[model samples]
Target chain A: MDLFINLAHGFSVALSPMNLLFCLIGALVGTLIGVLPGVGPVATIAMLLPITFGLPPVGALIMLAGIYYGAQYGGSTTSILVNIPGEASSVVTTLDGHQMARQGRAGPALAIAAIGSFIAGCVSTVLVAAVGAPLTKLALLFGPAEYFSLMVLGLVFAVVLAKGSVIKAVAMIMLGLLLSMVGSDIETGQSRMAFDVPELSDGIGFVVVAMGVFGFAEIIRNLENQSEETRSIVTSKVTGLMPTWPDLKASAGAITRGTIIGSILGILPGGGAVIAAFAAYTFEKKVSKDPSRFGRGAIEGVAAPESANNAAAQTSFIPLLTLGIPPNAVMALMVGAMTIHGIVPGPQVMTKQPDLFWGMIASMWLGNLMLVVINLPLVGVWVKLLQVPYRMMFPAILIFCNIGNYSINNAPFDVGMTAVFALVGYWLLKLDFEPAPMLLGFVLGPLMEENLRRAMLIARGDPMTFLYRPISATLLAIAVFLLVLAVLPMIRSKRDVVFVEGET
Target chain B: MSDGIQAPSGRSGGFRIRNQQDFYGGLVLVAVAAFALWASRDLPGMRGFAFGPGTAPRIFASILGALGLIVAVGGLVTDGPPVERVAVRGTALGAVLIAIFILVSNYATPITAGLGLRQYETVLAAIVVLLVTIAIARGADRGPLYVVAGTLVFAGTIRPLGLVLASFISIVVCAAATVEVRWRETILWAAGLTIFCALLFVYALNLPFNFWPRF
Candidate 1:
């Protein structure tokens, strides 16, 4: 009953003229950038952070959320049409989505993806609303020790779930923690690593690092394979705009199962959406009677992963909204946005600012609805936009990103800093180090340190407090278990098999 | 997996270093950790169980250093993929040259200031290095160099020259990053984008951006 009333209030807020407009704009711009290969949601959100500075907190958040869904939707479109997955989550989509396109069933593949995503979005939005309040309540049980332990678990989850060498991932996390310690200490106000630069006192801006690592580094990498300029775009006109009844019936079960998988995984602190899509597609294949049909124009392939990813994308917000912990880099950027708006994320947000909380939740549903309506009819437009060569597109992105960086603090030094990090990101790519874990570590570092210090002080310097507390101990135990599981050679091979997408 | 590591050190008559990526990557991490430790050396540490600013940093840095060492050792004992080759020679060289130039300029300030070129020294040095590096760099490798140069141009010019000129120059400069650039098309596109960005950011969004050069 309370959920109903709260949702009603949320609908009222989301339906407001200004909020709706922002949602629409966010969806459009998100799709626009997400359609472009090499730019992920992290960079998109970081680049657009400056634009949200002036917006009211609710509107700003709504817009950012809209951008996320739009970006994912656009990624599917790119996969189907160009066989180029816009980002990692969409990589599996290209397996069968593009196959469907090649077989001249591009329209049905796209329609099913959109429909599946919409259904998943609807289900997950409700799940988020339902789960958010209880999770916030659960958060009330957490002490400083518990919070610290939880963060440790979250980082471990990131490492275990991330596709890379476990040792390298752990190293990256440590490096991120080290980098996060650059600014002044919270308790003492004593600068740990300003290096005499005034700007360093604020610590490195998250936006600058994000734009540098994901944005500019991606450009550098994309430039590497420009010699293979052949992009096989499906020039055939997309005729059937809707999936047939049989296509719908075939994907119904897959969609439900995908939504379930995505919702569960999305709550975990890791690369939820990427793994969710992969897991969904793999599960679909495993359960199918004719598993061999998966990579060869199977509509279930397009439906399941798309649904899972969208569901995962939305439900990943659960951790961020409930516990004040961002599950991934994109959510970390959301934390930055919230901080900038003078709204601290956590359990308190629900009780203190119910309107903001519920309104953002409601806006997500509306945003999903908008994506379906805006994207389906606009598929041809997106396909046309895809024909724009990368050569011309990159410079525009570069200029805009530079301008965006400058706008953050009106500081040119930030621009220079971004260039440096871009170099670092490019170098990391060469070294086979995944930047995602490092980013998650950077986001959680200060919080973890603060909690650890508080817990220690409360326990009068006894390290045993973490072990003594049941919740904290459990979290730490799980983290260790996950770490061990990831390190085991047998599990590692299985993990690799799950991630292997058949590239034609 | 057993062939390389299980064999005696001199079995193949060589001390083979496997997994160069992890080896170098781990070494770099160790260096970074060391740098962090050095940077935080002055901050106070534990005072009777209470952390004094530096405790957390020193702790994490030490952990990172240990982890880095483990990775480096793993690289030695384990056989894995070799480091992927990337066209970073030009980019790396440019960075090295820039560092050298900055160090020399800082140390030899008296020499540079005597010529009344102190204010222009860094900027001039950067431009020259960028040009030389771009010229010498392979066609594919120039992307990052040109992109970096473009960003620096925007950073350097945005204040003095204002948004229009800064954005225009940066866009044009960045277009040269790829060999596929068509000059006329790029110039027109840059100009159009400059106008659009200036209007959107300055007028529509009303961010406090100057339209023309302050001077």
Candidate 2:
């Protein structure tokens, strides 16, 4: 009953005229970027982050949330139409989604994808509203030791889940931690890595790092691959915007199962929409009577991963909203945005700012509805956008990036820092190091350091105190288990085989 | 499907042992870590029971150094592709542009004072134009040139020319970098994008940027 009243209040806030308009704009821009290859949600969000600064906290969050899930919807459009996954989570969709397109069933494939995503988005938003309060309550119970242990577990998960050499990932995380140690120490006034620059006293801005690593690096990479094959739309005409009865029946079960699986995985640290989509696809293939049909226009293939990724994208907000921990790079940027708005994310956000919390929850449902209405009719417009050459597009992207970075602090130094990071990011890419883990580490570093210091102070420098606390001990144990599982040759080899199979 | 938009997998070329990327990457990390460790030596640490600023960084630096060693060692035994040659012209041009921005932003007054230029802003603008022209002449890819120029122009001119004019000029310059440059279309795009940005960022959102040059 109380939940109902709270949700009603949330609806009142979200349904306000201004908030709704921002939601529409966010969704439209998100879809635009998502349909364009190379320009991803991370860069797009980072670029648009400054725009949100002037918005009220609730409106800012609602719009950003709209963009996050809207990108998931738009990603499938490209996967089915152009045989390109606009987002990483949509990679698996390209296999069967493109196959269905090739068979001239692009309409049904796209319709099912949109419907599946809509269902998944609606379900997950409800799940977030229901489970988010309890999660926040639970997070409030954590002590400094527990918090430190949880962060350690998060870092381990980040390393284990990254699809490359574990050692390189660990190194990247350490480097991020080292980088985060720049500026003045919170407790002591001494600067760690500032090297005497006045700007170093405030630490490197998250926007700088994000734009540099993801935004600029991506632009350079796209330029390097200028000879990429032009994507041809699979069909000029998208007929029958609705799926057939049989097609609907086949996907109904997959959608339900995908929503469930994705919801669970999305709550886990480092378990993002990308992994959820992959896991759901693998689960569907394993359960299917005709697994051979997976890569050859399987409707279940189009439905399941699409649903799972959307569900995961929505639920990935759970960790960030409740526990103040970002599950991935996009969420990390959200944390940056929230911080810029003078709102520190965590358990307190739920208690002190119920309106903000519940309003954001309500807006997710509204945003999902907006996406379906916007996408279904606007498919042709998106297809037209697909024809825009990459060369023409790159400059616009670069300009936005420049203005975005500059607008953050009105500092050209940040722009320069972005340029430097772009080069560094490109180098890291060439070296097989994933930047996601480094980002996770950077975002969590200061908090982890603070928690570790507090925990040590409480323990009076006794390292064994971490083992004495049940929650901290359990979390640490899980981290160790995951590390061992990742390193063990037999398990590692089998995992690689599964990933390779999925890749093909 | 092609992993085109995803993060790089570092498996672009055929396998080689000699110039392993991890080897070079590890060396760089190790050098950075060592430098960090050495740099923090002067900072005080471990005041009473609580850890000081230096302790946490030292711990991180040491771990990074160890991980770097392991990665470097693994590179020796692991079979992987050689490090690909970086696009030197693009990279150098990018560096030069950044250096110029930083120098102009930080030391513009000092530089103009030293050179005794009566109109430092004009001199700075000329220098930017000259650098970009040289870069383009030296076969720096036009794509990067546009990006560099746009960023530099926005950074340098935002104060003098304001948000609207700065963005318009930057966008126009950037649009010319494309393979097929239509001046009319480029001008239209620049005008459209500039107005859109001005309205969205400056008017509706009301971000604290100068709409026109203060001077």
Candidate 1, CAPRI quality class derived from DockQ: medium
Measured with C-alpha atoms, the lDDT of residue B104 in candidate 1 is: 47
Candidate 2 wrong stretches, greater than 4 Å: A490-504, B1-19, B87-93, B100-133, B136-149, B172-188, B213-215
Residue-by-residue lDDT tens digits, candidate 1, A1-504: 989899999999999999999999999999998888767788788778888888899999999998888888888899999998887888989999999999999999999999999999999999999999999999999999999999999889888887767877898899888888888789988887888888889899888887887888888878877878568999889889899999999999999999999989888877888889999999999999999998999999999999998999999999899999988778888988898899888889999998899999999999999998988999999999889899889998888888878987898778878887888887887777888878778878888899999999999999999999999999999999999988886333423634421110
Q: Which stretches of candidate 1 lie over 4 Å from their true place?
A: A490-497, A500-504, B1-4, B7-13, B85-91, B97-126
Query: Please, what are the lDDT tens digits per residue for candidate 2 over residues B1-215?
Result: 11122333477664435437777778889998999899888878787768888988899999999889877766665556877655445656667766665666555676665776433553375357546644563322665555556666766677666788888887777665545567887788878888887887777777778888653
Clashing pairs in 2: none
Model 1, B1-215: lDDT tens digits are 12234524656657766777778788989998899899999999989879889999999999999889877876777666776445346458546544644454346557547776544444444455456656665666677777777777676667767899889888987888788889999999999999999988887777888788753
Residue A59 alpha-carbon offset, candidate 2, angstroms = 1.0
- Local error of candidate 1 at residue A359 (angstroms): 0.8
For candidate 2, write residues A123-186 as lDDT tens digits. 9988998888888889999999999898888888877776767777788889888888888998
Alpha-carbon shift of residue A493 in model 1 (angstroms): 7.6
Native-referenced TM-scores of chain A, all candidate models: 0.97, 0.96
Q: Each candidate's interface RMSD, rounded to one decimal?
A: 2.4, 4.8
Error of 1 at A445 (Å): 1.3
Candidate 2 lDDT score at position B52: 86
